[model samples]
Target chain A: MSTLKNGIVCSPAIHAPGEREITFSQAIREAVAEEMARDERVFVIGEDVAEAGSVFKVLVGLLDEFGADRVIDSPISEAGIAGIGVGAAITGMRPIVDIMFGDFTTLVMDQMINQAAKTHYMSGGKLTVPMVLRTTLGASRRSAAQHSQSLHALFSHIPGLKVAVPATPYDAKGLMKSAIRDDNPVVIFEDKMLYQQKGPVPEGEYVLPLGQADVKRAGEDITIVATSSMVYTALEAVDKLAEAGISAELVDPRTTTPLDTETLIESARKTSRALVVDEGYQQYGVTGELAAVIADGAFYYLDAPVKRIGAMNVPVPFSPAMEDLTIPSADYVFETAKAMCG
Target chain B: MTETNGTKQNGAELDAEHWLQAYEQMVRIRSFEEAANELYTSARMPGIAHLYIGEEAIAVGMCEVLRQDDYITSTHRGHGHCLAKGAALDRMFAELLGKEAGYCRGKGGSMHIADQETGNLGANGIVGGSAGIATGAGMSIKLRGTDQVAVCFFGDGALGQGLLYESMNMAQLWKLPVIYVCENNQYGEYTHNSKTAAGSMIGRATGFGVHAQGIDGQDIRTVYSTARLVVDRARNGGGPAFLVCNTYRFRGHHVGDIDRPYRTREEEEEWAKRDPLKLLEDWLTKTRQADASVFERIQQDVQTAVDEAVNFALEAPFPEESEVERHVYA
Candidate 1:
């Protein structure tokens, strides 16, 4: 069968090798599977995380391999899911919680911030919380404001958390493995639109360290830094800007908390112009913070004022037309980059 | 180096040292509470402090039976719990004083003092937060095949919280080594016990198939014996137990409330008359043949220790503002 009953592709073992490139969802599954096999402490838990796979089918076929003991299916309460994850982390097990939506993090903020973040510090650095909270974010497919928000800003403000917003299948798998290994709590913000986006992911265990930025493309005229879903948009925008005679440098700070300010400042110095695009709202968005940092550090090196292309200062709309306008699309990033270059 | 080992006390017979140790802790908690009340009323302390004056027996009683490696989770009224669990006096005092050398580096203050080395997992400000944590600690102990057990100390008010039931179910289901100690201190911030706790506290545990027991918290000996039995069962791979220590709080609900209009002055006097500290002291003298001079010497030692702790805390410097970003990660 091409797909399991749960609408997930069978493992590579079931089919011929090199038959097809792995999807983003399949990459995440393989990452968890390989890690769980390597470390007995690693496990997965969420609503339908074990028996029915995940809501997005990311954990499909894991239960059959790891058994119900490791791949636990929990109750529908998001608060309970986080609460259990915190408790399980404090105990001997390492848990990866699949929060169906990023919005549901609100229900479990106390467990996340108070319990998970402060436990090790409060215990005087004796305890470690090596847990991963994987949640889907961004506005697309008309999922509305509640389901489609890119709320990485809320977590980045917290001290103990390391936010990983991977924009590609390879980064998604590698960053997740790193988050699983990090002693502190890490939030893996997966874009809803990028789950089906496929790319090359190396087999076997791999990790992407926190606080590093990747220069996806090199240009001389303007520096454009974006994250998560906007990284793809910024790349597309670079292609369009090139046709318009604008050289746009694309930098994706794959990890948000340990923000690679060196990369950002260097690019701003070289191009002497910069533009930041974020899927979240502009007010107090990551774009605003990025602008302030660049203005403070790279003020003398810049030739023109820094620009920001961000979601409108409003909730994600339900209508496809309004949602399209609300999110930072490739056309908006391209226009913003061209304006920065000019 | 000398191997430091605690003298084991069985629940069957009351050994002189065991009873004396239990009474000494009860007296220390009482004196500390009395000092805290005076300090809080004098406005010497900056923040609101929850006094465990009348509820001394529960902490001293339970901790007396636990090994140094066994873990404990406490409520907002946590000073007594930490003191009874053998937290360093200077650090706890520094925490109370909001000094840099405090348990949480002066950040947690009175509500969140923890000493992980001695197995005090920090006091939780939330009403029912410790239950699940202690349950988790129990799971950890069992997973490692250790004899250690975790004792969760919560108020009667926490009995209504759903997390308590959730933790209890998990604890009983796994037969984890845990003892849920509900210090029924009779009030939840001005709400009477009758109004807050519906049904019986023991029934809350028995319903979850955990062996439940209610004992007189005014009698330190009784509390210690009952806790020893339950804790011993947990150490030997038996299931969890729910222990209800029927107790009272002699002071106001918090440091801010001077006028306890909810409860009558006569009721307070009546509870105070059966003071656990005085009762244990009297019992030691009359029944156990202990000397008055010995008790006086113990009192003087505790007073000197507390004074030194206060001085250390007052002299300790506050953490610098530049260091705020430090220790955010492991």
Candidate 2:
């Protein structure tokens, strides 16, 4: 078994051995594979999951490894898929359901919102549903508005759910592991752009606890809180801002709900300024909620008004330049932080 | 596969015990509903109560075929279901009164009454919601290798729900040991069945490959026999069956609809004339089977039982306010 170690960890065979390199897709595949092997109840079900693997090839070779039953290739029915998973989970099965695209979650909103989220409470706590719903969100490939929407904000608004939007390979593996094991229903939003990006991931089984924020970079002039693909954008913008001599602290909230609001609050209290970044639509987006939480939770510490950066209050257009203009970018984060600090 | 002789045992051979049980249940339901109506109109009860006055025989006939441990899923029209499933009158009455001593600690009122020991899953208020849940219960039984059967009680209006179709298909696909009992009370709320339903009820079940039948629900004997055959088949692993009990409601959908003009008096009178309670009574008296003294004794017994239940409920205390957040998580 090829073992790869980073920092202080060691485990079985990884595609990237002895190298501090693992693609985002490889990280996800490793997490699901290890989890399914560890737990008897873990199984994957989604469209094109078996014979063709996943559309993004993140689930490649899983069908051959786990057989057809565990890696189910379901019919193209999102509602039925989600509904069956809800039933299965309530009846003592842990299903890792894939909705292919985050946009298609709208088709199964009733199953997600009504059944999975409320069954435990509505049944007067007679049931405990353990299931992880994985969907790819965000757009950097010009997939257009229909296939490229970031709707995690909608799911985060729900109370009974736990939302995880991982930004890097290490966080992807760790957060996915945490999500799979969490008792509550978890929606793991994986950005499409981050899938092919490479980063250092530990070789062995690890769980990055949900509801904790990671300080990706440490600086005291300004605080930048970003999620999903925007974390990379924030890091890039920080590099350019460093050349321009504007030091900043960057925080990546690996999970949204049960958000690491404490970390963001502490950082805002120290820096006295915050720039919220997200890829969702402008109104009622994650940035708006984070800004509000900061305003209410740590208003006295703020030296300047909290700035928000998100997609335009419109659909994500198809053109490359327009798409960049639409979604919050590192340039946007940098610009907003600069203006706030100035 | 042992076969016994289908011999006739006096007039009782035609199910005298079963009919007697049905009559007892029908009588109990009628008295209970009447008492609830009187109490509700007087504002004695806590919440809106859906009386099962006009739909007595369906629950009685269906429950008669079920063993004490066999499960049944009820709807908002659940008083008859709880009573038929052998739930304690005191607990049920206490539940209706939102008392602490009630079945669900009075949290689940009339629509959500439940008695787990009796295998009466809580009465759901959502249309067709119980179908899949009952199917899940059947799955639970099958997985545990038990002979227990789950009876899903749904209104005719539930037939249009997709979960109904999805559950029916799943039940048939697995040959789940269940009985899908559709209580066709002729109306869904204010709308007539003719206006809402598509095709025949039997057709809907048969289309899903379940053995389907419809019986005159007002007649306890017919309901008992048909239910016995279907329920027995299910118990012995013959898969699920759909039995649509054709019946009617004598009173308005709820207690307050005294002036609704949706249906004619002729229709109501036609159904009321064949009330399951009177049908059993006529059969019993005509055959000189039960005397006026016996009937009076039965009436007194049921009335006393209902009175004791009401008194118990009235004396029962309300649940503590702290219990609200207690059951939200397991």
Candidate 3:
């Protein structure tokens, strides 16, 4: 079976028979460790990556394993870090550059969008900028507006970049490994909230392809398309919807760039209704794009208009209550899904 | 590569060989850029073309000191640097014409030209764009344990850019094998460097303690000598050097920009007094490296080369519309 449709093991700890549970952090660590062990050319560079092993601790123990030469700690220069990553990538090194926060992508936009994205095409296919710009994005930790953002849509819009948003531990490790090996520039948006979320990942060498979507729950009433941390929220909403006699299918798009429109279209066609959910701003975001694609692909099969449920249009505030108000909750998802089903 | 006597100041006693190479490179740039200007004026090439008219000496000086394997990242006004770093004439011309045979396969024109084989990272359209790249190349060299030094060429306008400061700091901290060559060509688009910049360009480097120095970029010998010391130091694991070469742009910021609104004719005339070509020609004649006939011969050769490039570009095929989508991914 294709890795995209891998059987979702419910409750990572309550694994079936011989399965093992792993967090999103452990999966990513294993992926990096495996890739580093496999290829001597691969290395990680970012702020606090060496001694600290990154602020999120996703790269813990890597410095000891790979040594400082491979796991470099960069200064707080987003543009420089990005440019250095590009330069090293085109020359020889397979660099996985962590930008710390997705909000800082604005600071390094010239290098990421202008230099890294355009290098391969600008060089007449004579050079390949094979690298991954990894960043953690979300508003759960109350990082406020500056530190939290879901700007994968901005990167996905760029022609030369491949955007990957892995919402599960299984997909995170597999997709990261795949991104590292791929010969084009890839941007991996890791949700900060899902780092501790547990799931079963294969022990041996495994890789998941980009631009693939996974169906968590199969239902006939309505298909709920969710991204990143919102996937779990959709699963929660699915459970709630089922209690109310509304069978809602949960579709998690692993990679949002080469968006898995086919699977979504098929699901929308079958269910005859769709609800797109994301943590990004609803005005111009992944939900908006996916909703359009779903409509274009299966417009006639639709029982009602496509609904886009996302964060309220406001910067993620500091207070827990205010932040909670801004973020989409399970109740919100249930209400949207219920309305669609009704 | 014969060395001049240490006794001669600024290599004034240079031989005919060095004179012709320097003279030829400068002539090549002057001729090529003149052709590009005419092409833009005639509407043959339709894009913003930043010509490197008066900044030939800096590119030639830096490239001469660098080996073919060494890397150099350039700015938008980078045709001179590409030619100096051994970019193919026909390919560059083809790129400017948006033909299939171009350096960017016509995907990138004048502002975005890159020669990978020759180690020209790219001519970035963004100001101060090459700093991080050059530093990264230095990191690669250090990791690979190679003696290859990376040189980044940008204008004086880039001196105010934040990336330059960050890159210089990193280069100093790690002692990366990189050379930061700032060709301060007086203007960053329309504003004068003095009007926009607060302090000296050399201080930008010295503050980081990166062995900074300033020079008259019109004098090719001084430019070459300073670059040689810096490049040699980096190759031998000395560290990064931030050398500021003060040059002037005889042309406007771009092909079509008439600088009458921002700059003055008198000021242009004043700076033209120390034109790099004249300085080199005067030195060559005084040193008896070449007579009038030899100068004419070298100019003729460069003219012929430029003419050949134009013809090749004119005859080259434009990229197919279907192929436009190609290379966007890889």
Candidate 4:
């Protein structure tokens, strides 16, 4: 029910300590609300950000809190909305633009790639695009191929963009705050399935710096690096592995670009085994990139070729059973880590 | 009776100072393009450049009505727009030469030059790319509660692009301080406008409830006069408006197109006769506002400036090889 301001909890501190449980969506909403309140230059513009509060409700309270002038409900024009963000950012404003779905980024490719991403560099650093592009990623809501794809690799591959894939409430809140304040174009990928997922978020000012990886649970047998919703699956696998005395460690890379390969390499060197879990397609995805990093950086330390677990290399299906079969499940991570340990 | 008076024109007369200033701006744009062409042909300036030949009046006229802080989104053919909006020719020439001193610091050659200080958001390579940006900028100005307005400059070729309509709708609905200018230069790359557009370009913006107008883009005074009214309406909280300037490009789509297969030499020469520069000069001389001596003096100034720009770009250094990854982010 409370919003943040300048990274501090604007809520009455009547609750216990400076920490409480919050959902992933609330964490993200708090970041936007807080940043908007703090900086007059910051504003949110997208489809249904004002009236509908976003399809996923991640921007629920922004409209009333900031009023219509700050929280703009744009028409269903992805390219237009994105181009506006690029334009606005360069000309003395920090805009938080939301594309309803990650797949819709194709419509904004020119705006993002040619305009937003290149303005800072092309202007010889004279101009800066201080903006954040938030989009929902991952399948499972039966949105099918068009809406369900995890295409972080597409934007992350570009040289100019900073891609953030936050998994938990804490990370969702922390990274979103950092992104809104960033002076360059940053894309924040929020997983649909993680919306209701809960975690302990700080009740005070907090910001997780971009490009750093968090070691969620430490162990000795083997290490598993996960991203976004897959981090939850990796956590579940870790719970199961502990019962069998596997001692599996979990590393959640909050962002893919500006990746924290050093942490993964250090974990690999310590454990002598690793498994990367990602919900994206197995081929040419984040999994391959992580595997390559471990293979090249921790080649001697990795005893088992630095294995990986990703969704099936095909378009996401509609049926619940088929979708479950395609996405990387807890059992998939458990088995992959189990094999690496053996 | 047909005096080219900047100050005394139809109730909204600008000073004589305005006309000469606008004249100098137009002449500089022409000379800059001429110098760039010479350098590009000589292989001194790299990459393909989109010369704003035969269309200098539109940028100069529109820019004349804008303040230094007012924003304008430009198209690929943007050299004239940048100059008219106050971008230095030295930096533009350096950008063309891939020098660190260029507007884009050697990264965005030709199609992507920009100047943030003067509020020229950018010259977009994408067709109709800056429409949304101009709209957003309009939103920013309105939110900040300033009197500055934004201008989105596109060609008649962009009539088919959905981006223009989308941005226009928002600007009108929100009463954003934005003006959409369609330079109906009769060509979108190789295809002519008549071959591609569906209806009147003005109708497209009007469909979204924005005010619209059509003008003879070859006449610099007409452009300035028309833009002044619309720009004021925007800055003063009257929603968005549209201006479809019926213009032409005497040169090809690009430097080497030759425009051979597209049209005949006679058509090119025909448009050349209605050249905007010549029209402005005749208006000034016939009205006794400026004599042959004034024209001679302005020509010498622009020529010398262009030559200096070339030498500056040639002397400037290229960016360091190690900085290839810099500015991708802050």
Candidate 5:
């Protein structure tokens, strides 16, 4: 029950004994359904969200449960729909707008950045856009440059927007609920690769605060600060590092905007060596920011300079062979952490 | 003066009282813009101000038919719409003056004033920016099952923006209670609409299966009568409608653009002869609704109010430095 400076609980007891398991997509659907049931103001609006249940099928049964009024389909107009989400949110409804892929975020940037992100502040807090833009992030599906890109870092850089990058089913459900209930505009970047990944999710209701970081594995040798899909990769590297006699602590910053710098720096200080990992591009990406934070906060305690592992600063290639080389893998993190520890 | 009954003349079915109110609102918008122009030209007001001088009738006419709870999204040249939508004169001037008592506490300045109580979503700085917001408000109204409609006020320049077409398409498809008011003010910033927009404005909306109409923006009666029909249609679940108001911008784009080389002086002189205020006043007099004395009194009252509002803004304090970090998140 420990809380940080912003009153963010370090770790909530989300998992109960023998909790039911669900896929990441199922958790997302459950979260949206529960929210719509809890508040009549909450509804889903996006292309293919109604009958198609979204292109990724993450929202499979929402239409039948919520009906067409709440689970509405929209034209393939990203800016228009995102703007509708903002206008509706400010007026009275909590709209959950789904962008099919992370790359499509380019089409809605003006609405998200200019209208949604700046409304509250520009209106002097007289108005609030309580909306959530749910989109997918992550590469490696061989969807190529336009379809395959992790653009969470671009949104996190904006001041008013709260960016969430949940790494597990438990975090996804909990974070989605919190985002629906939040009064500020929030963007949730779900890694497409983790949609079908199964994990334990609790039956009872629970909400994870956006700014809190979760320590997946506690260690003392080197700290691995990862986000979204990279959290699992970092965990896999942690197991491999342990076999090599290296105790690596892994941290998942669930939300990037309201970042839990306290937990990240705490872990880095404890381990005295840190390596940041993310699927976003390396240049001006999330890893560079986290590395800078850890480097500054744990500067005196570090054994070596903090290292960063992000997607190679090149367009995601269409070929699987070339795409495989672009994204970071368990071997890359293991090798980087080992080198830092050495 | 040609004698005619007030109700049936000039295509307006409004009573004498409604016509008077519309005239006053148009005059108020003109006075407000004049005051704002004075502030900018005299080096008193900070930042840029887009005068809604010649386009006043469109805003006043459209808003005359709207209820207090109905929503409106405005554009960079939005002072007229905000005033017509019932924004207080003091707060409007205060915002333009960067005062703490402004609608946005001086943060929004002239182009970003938003009043939630008045259902003014905001005056956006970006051209064609509020089309989606207005369409979204309509979607919210539909989802909530409310009878209230949302009006999106933009210049003909916005017709060139893709978001407007996208919003219009969705609005028509979903049958959302939205009224897209395109004030075709002859020019888009410095360029004429002919150079910027290819097709007709009404054609763009009708292409999306939306009910579209174009009317004389200078005549307050025509503007009001058309707006009333469109707003009532949307409110009664008749779906979205596109209203193209053929108007002109009398002044330069902003107060600073004094020499408007983009447009000819002959054209300005031509449109000036059909000033919205002059047209309304002439109609009111000819219909025997109100005499010159009444129009003079209205002008005097508006001038006093504008003077007081300007003084209030001039005397108001700037926001505290600490407020800069506030309101970034709700």
Candidate 6:
């Protein structure tokens, strides 16, 4: 088995040699199509999901392949569709509720949180809601405050929900499949900026289990735990940190809810330092939670206190220059890592 | 009993047996609610419960026409609906008492009892919360090509909620097999409906292009006949319909709200005179369907069953503490 410089076992390879490359959007579409074909109970319901193929076009051609019966285009009623999704799931239908924008989650909170999340437990295991809610996260697309917020943390806080934030095309496909098959309610947040980014994906069926962390580039100097779009940001900083003789390990926690704290703590213990990067706000957000976890688990081994790099605590600005400054960038991660390594 | 115009007595064609069965079911609901109220007043039951005492006719009338596989989503005040839909009295009482053998195994106390075998989706705590769920069940039935239908039971308080309209709009647009039953029980909580709801209740559904009607809730015969027509239309792919049952809440919103200052006692007494149970009982006696002895026998038998259920709940065990984390996932 491959091992990092610090002698910790590395995760198994996600892609084999000469694997075909596909865009993150294409990977998502393929996963949905495959699942729908495999299970007749699987169907997609949302606004503009049928002929429009989603506002992001991530679901393009799904309408044609699945037909109108499965690819149902609903009225602009997020709460209504989400409730329907919960109701349908309990009654033997595996529904994928596609919220065009993650901001509209506010509209469906009652259904997703109060209804879907509580049904199984409230029913004392009698009813199971095997449903998936697919939406986008991250900022810097000039979409302004409402559309640009990374709200995965909100869902992660809920007890019954499983939150998946995939950073790459390969992870997107595998994670989507896993979420579809999960018996509980799951919310998968895809980074809008990473939709066009291409990555290696296999031809055959595969699924990456939830709660498993992936070590993108294992190192021994400092451990960097990132989620969703921030994974790419951390990876970019790894190259710059290498020039400075800093071997920064990059860990991608694909699902925030079923977080793989053991891997993160082991990385932090080996490196003696940890930095959590996420696109959510710095205060009471994903970064704070992960940093606390690392600090608590690897406290005695750490040379310095755990650090958190996240979006500035403000609504996403509309202007490009302002928005760019709000989110954590590669330079920010590099500078923070260099200072910590010193 | 005051038989208002447009009240169709389609149930007149039925034999004494059917009417007797309806009377028995209504009596069971009344007994269940009375026992539940006594438990609360005597401080035996935990939390609070919304009584469906005065509106027994609506639940029994509507649930009578539904098939065993047909679905129903209930409100906070849902004991009557559960009993009418064939939920066992023992399980229902056990659930209200938070027992391990309850319908929801004590996880859902009073407001959230879900019985899968009887096709009860659940009783929601949130006003108008079950509207979308019922509509979705309708959507599922249509997709699966089943002849089943779903009924959504809510109060006039739900008429002010936007989710109800959103659900109704989709139910009509897609031609889903759903029946929206609005039990306008005169008051939304402590306030009367006239102060809370504007415009006609039926107009709201009719505005969405859904067939809508209003019926006197006190009369079991009218409620049953109306429910039969609407349920058959929905099961035969006739899309959605809305039925407004004009009724009254004979008790406080919850067991604790005793001194109701919103409405006068004189008004309460006036509505009490048209009690659904008395109306049904009087009809049975006047028509000689059976003598007063038959009604007396039903009351005694139903009371015994309810008393046994209460005893079962009191003796049942509480769920293990570890069970708290068991079913959170699946």
Q: What DockQ do the predictions score, one after another? A: 0.36, 0.26, 0.77, 0.68, 0.86, 0.80
On the 0 to 100 scale, the lDDT of residue A131 in model 6 is: 95
- For candidate 1, write residues B114-223 as lDDT tens digits: 77778887798888777767876776676557799889999988887787887787778778898999888899889998987778889999998999999888878778
Candidate number with the higher lDDT (1 or 3): 3
lDDT of 5 at B317: 95
Q: Model 6: clashing residue pairs?
A: none
Model 6 lDDT tens row, B1-330: 223223235687777788888999999998998899999999999999999989999999999999889999999999988889999999998999999999999999899999988899999999999999998899889888899999999999999999999999999999999999999898889888899899888999999999999999999999999999999999998999999999998999988888999999999999999899999888867767776888899899999999999999999999999888988887
The reply for model 3, stretches above 4 Å from the true place, is A1-16, B1-7, B12-14
The segments of candidate 1 whose C-alpha lies over 4 angstroms from its true place after superposition are: A1-21, A87-93, A120-127, A141-146, A312-322, B1-12, B37-46, B159-162, B193-214, B236-238, B282-286, B289-294, B317-322
| Better by TM-score, candidate 5 or 1 | 5
Worst 10-residue stretch by lDDT in candidate 4 chain B? Answer: B3-12
Q: Best to worst by lDDT, what's the order? A: 6, 5, 3, 4, 1, 2
lDDT of 4 by residue, A145-199 (tens): 8899888888888777899999888889999999999988999999998899876
The DockQ-based CAPRI class assigned to model 5 is high
Give TM-score, chain B, model 1: 0.93
TM-score of each: 0.87, 0.82, 0.96, 0.95, 0.97, 0.97
Q: Give the TM-score of chain A, superposed on the true chain A, for all candidates in the order listed.
A: 0.92, 0.93, 0.95, 0.94, 0.96, 0.96
Give a tens-digit lDDT track for model 2, residues A215-303: 77777888888899888788878777777788888888888887998999988888888888888887988999999877777789888
Go through the candidates in order and give the C-alpha RMSD of each one to the true structure: 5.9, 5.2, 2.6, 4.0, 3.2, 3.1
lDDT of 3 by residue, A1-342 (tens): 121223342434223446687999999989989999998878888899889988999999999999998998988988888888888887888889889899988888888888888888887888788899999778878878888778888888887888888888988998999999988889999999889988877677778888888887788999999998888888889888989999888898888887889999999999999999988887788889999999999999999999998888898888887988877788999998898888
Candidate 1: give the clashing pairs: none
Off by over 4 Å in 6: A1-13, B1-8
**TM-score of candidate 6's A chain against the true A chain:** 0.96
lDDT of each: 0.79, 0.79, 0.87, 0.86, 0.91, 0.91
Candidate scoring better on TM-score of 2 and 6: 6
Docking class of 3: medium
In terms of DockQ, which candidate is stronger, 5 or 6? 5
Give the lowest summed-lDDT range of ten residues in model 6 chain A.
Answer: A3-12
Give interface RMSD, per candidate: 2.6, 3.9, 1.0, 1.2, 0.6, 0.7
Clashes of each: 0, 0, 0, 4, 0, 0
Task: Report the poorest 10 consecutive residues by lDDT, candidate 3 chain A.
Answer: A1-10
